[model samples]
Target: MAEVAIRGVHKSYNKVPTVHGVDLSIADGEFVVLLGPSGCGKSTLLRMIAGLEEITAGEIAIDGTVVNALEPRERGCAMVFQNYALYPHMTVAENIGYALKVAGTRKPERRARVAAVAQSLGIAELLDRKPGTLSGGQRQRVAIGRAMIREPKVFLFDEPLSNLDAKLRAQMRIEIRRLHQRLGVTSVFVTHDQVEAMTLADRLVVLNHGRIEQIGTPTEVYRRPASRFVAGFIGAPAMNFLTGTLAADGRIAIGSGAGTPVTIGVRPDEIQLLDAPLKGTLDFEIELVEELGTGQVFYGRSGEMEMTVMRNGGGEAALPRSGQRLFLKIPMTCVHLFEVESGRRIDLPPSRLAAE
Candidate 1:
């Protein structure tokens, strides 16, 4: 395991910068996930660390040594790409040991290493199968096993589970985390899926466009997003956004147009739908409802303002239905406010908001 340090890294194509000046540090044995939407430069940054892409300006040091000019093989990092990149003609065992064989590792020692990696990945029995015969998940495991066979100091994954189905992706996530635990190697994973980022990362580096947005533990980013983009992007079904101004009367003044606005964000789960209206409570016109087994999300509008409220299913309370008129109690403490102009979060005194 090794500590990976990135200092003021920048990358460009045709003089147009794709990765802005970015600095980050990965502790030894830490799993850091770079998460964002497509075209966010996360993969470019990961490739820079793997020596597949050149940094326009800045330093990438692996295990305390500068690796700016070093080749990929010399950086002591193993990468698992989004595509499995397995050789179709080779059996699982041959594919996993190819790196070692190319480097002139003795056949006996290489076979022993391959066997160990396969067993560790729970794919020992599949060693005889070719890539064509295996399932998507099995092929993915083979890709992982190949990377593991190298025993590199750092592990880099570029959306390694994107090729798998939903259930397989979920299963692979746990296995990847366990693999990191067993190997204790410095790992950097890039993904656009929030679920993957939340479940698999010790810390998350949220990126947008070509720059760093926010970097923190999953809870920190989810509970207290630094910006409106971070808040909206990090959550599922997206955080509900209501454009209005904080009025002097302690109410949000939402008009039809996007006027001078203060954006209010409400997590779906934090919204409470009451059967009767209470003082300070707002009205919601329920338009649709989705019950996704584990929970239910209510989609509706407040006047012209759209919102969603999430509630646990199979509960005692009657589920709110479409066409129903429900009063919403927006807990002040659970609400997030942002400056609409800059799309930056605005911190209001929680105690003060709660009291109002």
Candidate 2:
């Protein structure tokens, strides 16, 4: 295991910057995930760590040794690619043991190590099989085994499960986490999937337009987003946004037509349906209802502003359907306010928002 440090790292292609100056310190044996949308420089940053891409500026260190000048193999990093980059002609044993063979290790030792790794990954029976004969998950296990046999100080995954189906992806996620627990190797994973990032990361590094947006544990980032972009990007169905103004009375009026302008955000699950129009409640007209197995999602609008609300595990009789008008009580404790110009979050006391 190794502590990976990236300090003031920058990458560019032909004078057009792909990754801005990024500084992150990954603790030894920590599982850090770089998460963002496509073209957000997450992959570029991961490649830089693996020595696959050159750093335009700044230095990277592994286990306290500066590795900016080192070759990919010299950095003590083993990378598992998304495509399962295995030789089709080679059997699983040969594929996993290839690195040892290249380093001039004896065949008997190589076979022993390959068997051990295959056994650990539960692919020992498939050691004689070729890549073409294996399923996607099996091929991925072979790829992981290939990386594992090297016993590198660091493991890098570049969206390795993106090619699998949903069920296989979930299974691989658990397997990867188990491997991390059993081996305790320092790992860095890059992905555009929030679910993958949330489930796999000890800490998530959120990136956007070549810059780091936020770095925190999944719950911290979800419960208290630093910016509007993060609040919108991290949740399912996304957070609902409204243009409003904070009045002197500490109450928020739900439209631009009033008070000191600010942006309000609330998650779909945070809204409470009301029996009557309370002083702090907003009027909503339900246009559609979606019945998910665990809950129901209501899509509607409050005046001209579109909104979405989620109700978890309620009976059909207790739920409202399309064409129903309802009142929504947005608790001040659950509300997030942001600056209209900067999009940064504003922290407010609940007592200040009490209904008059």
| Candidate of highest lDDT | 2
Candidate 2 wrongly placed segments (more than 4 Å): 247-250, 257-259, 349-356
TM-score of each: 0.94, 0.96
RMSD of 1: 2.4
CA deviation > 4 Å runs, candidate 1 = 246-261, 314-317
When summed lDDT is taken over every stretch of 10 residues in candidate 2, the lowest stretch is: 347-356
Model 1: which ten-residue window has the lowest total lDDT? 249-258
Evaluated with TM-score, which candidate comes out highest? Answer: 2
lDDT of each: 0.90, 0.92
In model 2, the Cα lDDT at residue 107 comes to: 89
Error of 2 at 175 (Å): 0.9
Clashing pairs in 1: none
